[model samples]
Target: MWASILIASFGTYVEKLVGYLLPHHMLERESIRRMTGLLPVSMLAALVAVQTFAVDQTLAIDARLFGLGVAVVALLLRAPFLVVIIVAATSTAFVRWLGWLP
Candidate 1:
């Protein structure tokens, strides 16, 4: 077991070292940077979509959608980050408390 852990840790360390040593020119390409910049946002959006719109093995839209919309509106209005999170969470909790979802 210790051997396995040592091997795994060594492999991970090597991979990170290679990434850290890679030539900057490779990452400096305009298209690469642009796409990389969007990757995080796209991934988070996908995660949120799955959680908000899926139920068990199927798809469903419910009160979570309302909370998400409200949160988005608050973000677009440049509300403080904490305010957006709190409003979204509170709205979701209130909806659940009211038994808006079955």
Candidate 2:
């Protein structure tokens, strides 16, 4: 067990070290940087869209769609971040509880 743990720890450390010590210029060209910057928003949008529209692994509009709309409006209005999260979550939960989801 100890030997296994040591090997795993060493492997993990080496992988992390390689990641940290790799040349940034090699990994982060202009196009790569632009793509990286866009990635988070795109990923978030995909997640939100999927969650809003997915039911039992099939596509169907649901309460999460309204929640996302409210979230967007809250973001546009510069509402407090916590308030927006709370409002979105509560609104979505309420909508779900209303049995409007199908």
Say which candidate scores most in lDDT.
1
Q: How far off is residue 2 in model 2, in Å?
A: 18
Q: Give each model a TM-score.
A: 0.67, 0.65
Off by over 4 Å in 2: 1-20, 97-102
Q: Once model 1 is optimally superposed onto the true structure by TM-score, how far is the C-alpha of residue 78 displaced, in angstroms?
A: 1.7
lDDT of each: 0.88, 0.85
For model 2, how does the per-residue alpha-carbon lDDT over 1-102 read when each residue is reduced to its tens digit?
999999999998996796589987865689977997898999998987787788777887777788888899999999999989998988888888987753
lDDT, model 1: 0.88
Task: Give the alpha carbon lDDT tens digit for every residue of 4-102 in model 1.
Answer: 999999998986796689987877799988997899899999989998899988998888887898899999999999999899988988898999863
**Candidate 2, pairs of clashing residues:** none
Top candidate (TM-score): 1
Please give the TM-score that candidate 1 achieves against the real structure. 0.67
User: Residue 28 of candidate 1: its Cα lDDT?
Assistant: 76
